[model samples]
Target: MALDFYTNPMSRGQIVRWMLEESGLPYEEKIVAYGPEMKGENYRQINPMGKVPAIVHEGRIVTECAAICVYLAEMAQEADLAPHPDERADYYRWIFFAAGPVEAAVTTRAMGFSPQPDQEVMAGFGNYDLTMSVLEGALSGRDYLCGARFTAADVYVGSQVDWGLTFGTIPSRPAFDTYAARLRDRPAYKRAKARDQALIEAQNQAQGPQN
Candidate 1:
């Protein structure tokens, strides 16, 4: 049976789509429009959070971006995209690290939300500059997050770097540029990205201009 991927081209859903391609797993793609209707009855059954990038595999529902990515990596063990048993610690470390603070900083910048001086302690991401600096430090000397070879961590982290570069949310430092370029050169990444870009253009055309 094929995996079922629920996604939206314009959102974080694109990351999971890329993972599906890299996993070499056949998935049936279902596009969900962004609106309250998606959050209504239907999507809630898949994810109570009404989020995209969820998947249904073998009658089990998996939501959350990183969860789904890790799940798929495990399911396609032959791909060997995930870290080995010994590397598991570092794998989960950077994976969640990217999902947590890195994502927080990126989204906060995208939304134009800044933590005031008094709220800095309470702010999960601290500040964008700090977040980027930390990430650069992590990726500086390592070709991949786990060292020389690419792992599933690259899929997740590379997605962030790719999106950051595209949206100008993350600075294009030498390390980031090299890493994202490497990921982009992958055939699977190219295919998935092209499909999403086409879908986005189609959606825009359909919407046209509204007064």
Candidate 2:
């Protein structure tokens, strides 16, 4: 089965890129720029959401960063990126935790809005402060989410911590710094970053100096 990766170098596609690299899957990369190209009928057929970071594998369309990471992990059995049988509980818990609460909290915070005390009950993350605390506690003493073992959950959850620290959306902490550093040291992460960096540089050069 052909693996078709649709992404823009600047988008969350980087997450899927790292997953793909780790999966050791040879995939066709399709760069869909923002605006018309991404929203065009041709690409929309592939993903109705008209977003980057969607993949077509085994003749099925998979969208969203978290789902893509989990799917690749399961498919790439030889790589063992999926959690071991015993770690399944923590694996699903944190993977969706990152994809849900961590993601919601960070995004809402960055947007300059957080749920009030009463509103917190409605917010799935409760509040940024609580979400951050819980996330930190999850990674505090363990080398990985599943107790010293790295899984696809790390790719999803780790990206949240890594980006949060880098972009200042999530507050900085020693635990986050150390966790992001560990993920940065992975060869797959480095490779995905480098490839995206190259593309960004090329795009910049083509556009020339900006005003």
Candidate 3:
């Protein structure tokens, strides 16, 4: 019944924070600073990747933003974030799509690494352009990833689109714009974002003005 969330306010932990709020579950937040704090042996034992945004639920550890979202959704069944029986197909398909192609494409672009045309087949996302096009089509006429109803899939996928637009990694397509707007309107989204933003501001203040 107890959950511990390890994260850094400025990292992808924001995505899991939103999912926590959406799941309506109470969790202990452990702030793991970057660099040595994150990679220290103690923390490394919790997450082999030495990354933030990990959760220990009833002693079971879950890492990775997308994995954590789906895990929480299943735990908080009453919140209805998990996919319904009828939505199963689209649910798993798109959630993993976002976790896979969308996630890879955005990161590769951000890192300034583009897969050459011939390397497309070797790349999980092919190329950023192709990846975005596929995502755009999925969201064109839907309010959420699984359709009109919102589910856990939207949290992961929406976070990607939301983050993409904010950082200029994902193009500002009309479909992306509409989808992001819908997800952002959720009360949980607001709460999670505000909490992370406050933490960021506090950290910045502690560091004082930087050149």
TM agreement with the true structure for every prediction: 0.93, 0.98, 0.98
Candidate 2, TM-score vs. the true structure? 0.98
Model 3 C-alpha RMSD vs. true structure (Å) is 0.9
TM-score of 3: 0.98
lDDT of 2 by residue, 115-169 (tens): 9999988898899889999998998988999999888988889988888888898
Off by more than 4 A, model 2? none
Worst 10 residues of 2 by lDDT: 163-172
Per-residue lDDT of candidate 3, residues 1-211 (tens digit): 8999999999999999999999999999999999999999999999989999899999999999888999999999999999888898988999999989888888888888889989989997899898999999999987988888999999888998998898899999899998999889999999999999999999999999999
Clashes of 2: 0
User: Model 2: clashing residue pairs?
Assistant: none
